[model samples]
Target: MKKKITLLFISFFILASCSNDEDSSIIPVAPVAPTAIHAVLNEGSVDITWTGVEGAGITYNVYRNAVKINKAPLTEAKFTDVLKNTGSFVYTVTANLDGAESTKGVVSEKVILELPKTKTMQSIDIYYDTKYEYAYTYDTSNITKLVSLTIKETNTDLTYKKVTVTNTVVKYTYAGNLITKMSYYSVDDIPRSSVENVYNAQKKMIGRIVKRSDGSINYTVTYKYNEDGTITETNDARDSGVGIYTFGKGNLVKYSITTPMREDEYLAVSNYVFDTKNEPTLNILGFNFFVNNSKNNEISSSTVITLNGELSSTESSKSDNTYNENGYVLTTMKTLKVSSGETLQTRQTVITYY
Candidate 1:
């Protein structure tokens, strides 16, 4: 019984000794101070700079109006927002260390927006060439009513051809800002081997359609924004198609079509490759209906055609053309080469009535 008592006393003594030593070694840690924070405003952005907290292994939490806007790692010391619209904004920068956040440095600034004048009518010349010019008189005071668009083309025979395209369109306004209206028209005698010269506007073409003639009906286009403030494109076709685009850090990364269209079997799919400066490296296979509009009946494999920001290597086709000093192509040319390696060229002489 004495041995058992002695053993229990020794164990108790050892336990008490360990407990006291642990209590003695406990040391309190001090809180880190927020340091060296500054904010600057540049042309269209806000720049924030700060120093790292000493021995805190801290990250950053940027808040705008109690809502966390961004989170950065311990290594980062700067952040900038390029989209600062005209409004008063509150900012808070908090320090995070070991899953704990420190008190924030708060700042507030107001963005100023200076917009130019709207709702004004002016006369501008829509020039076809040095010789071909027309005066466009726009009166936005009543944008829904008919605004006159009268165009005159100068011919080589020193004569002016006056062609008029008039329509009554309704215009919407945001206070005084003018909203665009959808327009539709067709052109005739575009020189296609096939007699079908009509094209549907809702087909989503990648290039601009210059009116050579007039069409039957006008198609509509509506623009809207995504939840993330990105643009969404939806067409007004009988079978409507939609697409959303995503941009890389600063460059256009990819665009995807969604809803009611197959990715593989769709009418068109384009992949644009770019260099470091976002200039196009190559346009793999962009399609255009302008090939049918050329006066040439046969297309040769060796023919090369260059348009604004685009190039195509197709077969040489004959064309009949009319040209003017103002750079308006009134007519096309005839095709002479059926096989590759022959060059066929034509010119159009334009005459404008001013």
Candidate 2:
């Protein structure tokens, strides 16, 4: 951290004699500097505060790396730089008077910019069932790599005899630039199943192997790319299923799954509509490596189920969102409904980036 100290400057008022050569009584006005300028990292932004210059009619002007960043002389000794990129930064502040900026003092602080690493998804179910929280650990040595993730879940239903809490931790293993596996464990130290990825000689992932806690094979999924650019997934487990994923404009637009339901095979189809804005959670490093809702913010989605090719049930959901200037989602209001038009529940989520 660097501090820019404003040195006291005395502007001498030159006393000049009139034609009579008599000295005019005059005094010099000294300009005061702010005590210090402090820039601290806060929630992926820079918070800058400076000790006020003790005087009336004096304001403050903030500078970043010698460039004035504020549009007007600030009445207060504080400024917040909402950063859009990361790098080393220097901040300075000086008092202002009569449209003139005072000299900046000599304390300097260097701030290293960090990528918006953490996103807290604080969600409240309008229907009150569960709450979810997640935090990710960044490999500080190489910040682009996400090392681990922790998830906290709470049972919010008061009808339950007692509420329960569960904690899950996920760790990632990578091979070069590709993510190879993700392992899961409980906070209490209980181990869970792990999923391993299978890649072809071309470094393209072709399948995934799920393993039991004891290292035995649980199930496997194979992937195939279609000529039309859609992808198909075959699951050897889970009632022997097949799924097709359709993509559009860098997002998954539709998905359909076929699985045996009792004696007949049922088909579940889902469709999604996305906004052009970038998804907020996807800003986290290494998150885009997963096959999921990462490319764009989801606006609306629907799912339909058919038993033996006959219509069964249908449901749809929509999201309303507010975003920061960088186009990252800051808040989302979600609503869900059934085919009968009965509202299921509403959910609100606020995301903070750190």
Candidate 3:
């Protein structure tokens, strides 16, 4: 019995010793650095993605410009950062495991943010034996709202007497940065018209209602967007019209409008061949409903507008534009081909940015 008891005690002691030795040898290891860090530049943001570490219970810390940006360690391997300005930004990510942080993996990128101008003034002067000058002012106190627009027109000859010296004012109201209401007033401070715009959650204009000065609904237009981003607009009083828009490298490439009344079933079409900068032609609204949601008023290289599907060179209107160093339209020469002859028109537009 004593031998047996002693053997049992020895066995128990050996087992306990082995258990303690195994416990003391075990130590927590630091996490490895994140791999395959990538930064994708967007219009006003940057998307960063990386391969996650293999270790369990791993978390990540993201740093921008050498400063930590995330409020807490993130478990996901991807993050999106909204940028305020345009410039170069450096990003680094570090992995953490059990309170131990690994060395950071770095990536650098230059971000060019295309934010809309806050306050803009554009003056266009057209000359063709007669002179017509138009001035437009846009106020964007609220970033998402276009506060007001003032349009002034002057003509040197009364033969082109549609333009007046008095300023026409248009006030805009917004919902979530999308124009919802537009009120127009004549120079005499008389209400001329009011337009109400309705948009879906995607910020695409879905419907528009126009009201004349007498507060009666003059017309209503509804729009539908295809999955490919093309649009079809239908008026309550007329047949539907289709607008086909094409994009290349994230820039508007072409936009064609077709109406039922046209003989060839095409009202107007514009093909945009952009420079390296990918800027489009300037317009009064500073916004292209066909291309994007934002308001960008820049000049284009060339624009051709045809009416009633008339492909004849003698009936189309064409304009060629030149830009200044700041990308503003310096000069525009427009030729209107009439049935009788050709009429040459020149225009100079000056834009001020703030």
Candidate 4:
């Protein structure tokens, strides 16, 4: 009886030992912390990445500024945090395994502020050859208003003859961001000519009046718009002629001018072909402006005009524009087909940003 009892005890001890060994083998080990955490700053966001933990069923938890940001563990090794404003931030990542969290791996970054969507032009410098130039100045406090324009002339020859500098200064006034009046002056400070512009409630130009310095109206031009947001007609008081305009595909395709009494007498006619991305604005001139209107800033165009019902002229032009790192137009070169049957360099414009 004593031998049988001893044998039962030994069997029970062996069974208990085997059960403890199996439980020890099944116990999970905590995962190691992620290493080599890296952070990259982007416009209004931050991108973070780290070396993945080596184990089965492991995930990652992301923390920003020592606070847990993600509610659940991520299955991948990368994360992107969108910032509400421009500022500095810190991030850390930890490896998670079977409800166990490891130590964190850390990184820091700064979210740069985005620039304003629109910046009004502050100044313009026009180079009419090397000897003559026009420098336009604006009130930067109100970028929509141009204050003054000065014409400068350079003389390289040392001669006793006096250089006649006329119409050297011009003053401008604005009403609600629109040019309301402009007055030109000679070098002696005497007024030369003045122009007045009138606009409707929709900010569309309604009338333009040119006057001599003596305040006598020299000529007047009035404009009317169609329902589709295009200029339908213009009346010129100087020549007693009216111009009719027709548009196709949101572009001004043709225009013809005629006197009121003579319906068959067409003074002039012009037809234009625009690029796919043209936004016609009177603020700038040339087909290059149409191409510059594109997001890519590249364009080519052809135009034809008639005088007295005859094909008077044809022109072809192209423009190439380059941009700065901030996506602003840095420089542009325009080439035109001249009467000499060869391409001539017409204009070059450079822009500076604040």
Candidate 5:
């Protein structure tokens, strides 16, 4: 009875297993392909927010008059066309995910921003100065702290330090306020540092920066000038980011550039330096990386430096610069430390300009 049951059941079990295997082998059909893309500008540029490609790590191409203007991978979802006098422009984004890419989405937008009026300065002058007074407790320690400061003009020369400190007194002097030919003095009345600088009448920078061991930094910028005194290029070596500057529009605009890291990095970090007041005189940045449960950003690892100012030799104070509405520096504010001691007070000097 058992043998008969086994033989009869074997065939049925085999057929059932085959049927299950066949069912498992059948794959579901893939979804339909994505639709073709057509991009158009909702405002002045293409707005890709409505499409599924928003912030999708997509690659895009911008075109004007059916000719490609830009083809680059976008870090953001938005892109602007700053090309001058683009009559008609179209922007399209292509969604690239995995190995497959979606069809191009296109948009056309019109832009109209009125350019501003320009001017040529007949003559421009910029300068500033600062003085410091220090008071120190000789019995406690040799450290001296600045108690008071006075601002002065760059043209005026500082004679002596009026404050008395424990053992040290510092004085500052000026040959010129151009930031390249300034001078400083010590307690013994010995000249310690000298700074040098060069600029055009508009104060556009074009020079090299040199720091000597005697505590002096010099600036000598070179510019390509027209016979009429209009500038072509203004280059400065004191900049950590910007290197070469190409001028346009009758000295109204400047292109400050950082020396290219590899000649290729120039394309992205290269930006326009407009002659507007919104331009920054200093920029200090830092970046860090961390691993697994550890905070990555660092603080002490970075050294800070001023972008467009002269430094004092003894205390390393950055000089102040004053700007007008036309974006030119009109005056400079500088401070010099004198002396600090237990018995004597500090002295300050203030200067005015025409």
Candidate 6:
């Protein structure tokens, strides 16, 4: 009668142990890259937008041509960049999360710069008596921007015009209606030299500075206005002397330039006669830097160079011009002469509009 009781045995397996300590080897989640980046140009300004990752402690940064242009991190997904130059730019945006920045995405956009034209001068072509030619191009979209100046040593025939820019000079730059800089370009289109204009309180140009590509000053010229409405240009070079400029009715009637010689200083005085009509070159941007642009069309000129107060050489020029519908000079046939009234050459100029 002993108890034949049989006990059933059951076992439970524990998958995890209950503990108060937490996992210390856990890894953090990284920031996600931005997407759908876009850039738009609005009147010389760039507006950049992107889709950013949603997270805490998030920020954004803007890059232009791979250079960080943003002064500080942005919390929004949009940015506006005011451009000071006219050229193509590469734009990209980055996202930051929890003090960490995501690796830069391959997504990037490019924008070609554009500006509005404010003047009417378009292009000009000059044909010299020696078969040399010069063709100046303005911006196709913005005519006020002087694009490039092409010179052909002997290509006025228009037969073998090539795209060789090895012998070109500086391009024009402006600030509003005033042209401020001329950056000389070398064979590779690199600015190897430059000329800058300084203005006074009334926005009158008072000084001109020339510098080499190495940022060294070559020379400086200061312009002083006189009570009699004349201008005195003083050059800061040992070999150079003061230039006396006499203007009449917004035109340079007489100009004298002193240049250094091996033995004595040479003084060249140029006198001009003008017609009572607007000159086409006056409409051109940055053309007055050489003092060739006159409010009225220049019809005749005489130059006499003296060495040590003695006559050295004499020259003269007269232009036979045809006018346009607006009374602007459309074409000019210039006849140049020597001291003995001998005809040296005849040159031609043609202007075209957009």
Least lDDT summed over 10 consecutive residues: which range in candidate 1?
278-287
Question: After superposition, which runs of candidate 5 have C-alpha atoms over 4 Å from their true positions?
Answer: 1-180, 184-193, 198-209, 215-220, 226-252, 268-354
lDDT of 6 at 87: 60
lDDT of each: 0.39, 0.74, 0.61, 0.60, 0.34, 0.69
Candidate 1 lDDT over residue span 250-351, tens digit each: 443445443444333232222222223211111001112221121111112233332332443334433343433322333333333423545433322222
For candidate 5, write residues 1-354 as lDDT tens digits: 999999889989999999999998875432222233344432223343323444444444444555555566444444555333313344455455443555455544433221111211111122212233232111111111111112212222234423322223323222222233334444454655443444556643444344453665544445554565444444354333433333343222223333334433332112222223211111100000000011111111111222233321122122344554433334433332312212111222222211
- The deviation in Å at residue 268 for candidate 4 is 5.6
- Candidate 6 collision pairs: none
Any runs in candidate 2 off by more than 4 Å, and if so which? 1-128, 201-203, 281-286
TM-score per candidate, chains pooled:
0.27, 0.65, 0.56, 0.47, 0.22, 0.55
Give the higher-lDDT candidate: 1 or 3: 3
**Residue-level lDDT tens digits of model 2 in 1-354:** 123222212112222224234533343354567766788865446799878877778888788888888897799978898665556788888887755667885444776553444444444444456666777676655545668878888777655546678899888887765678888899866778799987767665678899988889999988887899877899889678889989888798999998887799699999999988767545344345455444788889999999977899999999999987666677788888889998877777766655
lDDT of 1: 0.39
Give the residue spans of candidate 4 off by over 4 A: 1-132, 140-144, 153-167, 233-298, 338-340, 343-345
Residue 225 of model 2, lDDT score: 75
Q: Kindly list the per-residue Cα lDDT of model 3 for residues 142-231, writing each as its tens digit.
A: 222245666665544435645435566788775544567889998777999999887777776788899998889988887777788666
* lDDT score of residue 165 within candidate 2: 83
How well is each residue in 132-211 modelled by candidate 4, as lDDT tens digits? 44555545453323577676554333244334433467787766456677798876788989988777787666777889
| 141 Cα displacement, candidate 2 (Å) | 1.9
lDDT of 6 by residue, 1-354 (tens): 233322211111121222212344344555878888888865446798888778778898888888889999999988998776656787877787656777664455777543222212212233221333445566555444576654444333224443332354557777755668878775467667888988777666788899998879999999988898778899997888889899888799999998887789789999999988656555454555544246787899999999999999999999887875556666777888889977876667765533
The regions of model 6 sitting more than 4 angstroms off are 1-166, 262-265, 285-292
Q: Which candidate gets the maximum TM-score versus the true structure?
A: 2
| lDDT of model number 3 | 0.61
Q: Please report how far candidate 1 places residue 2 from its true position, in Å.
A: 7.9
Error of 5 at 220 (Å): 4.8
Ranking by TM-score: 2, 3, 6, 4, 1, 5
lDDT (Cα, 0-100) at 230 in candidate 6: 76
lDDT of 5 at 332: 36
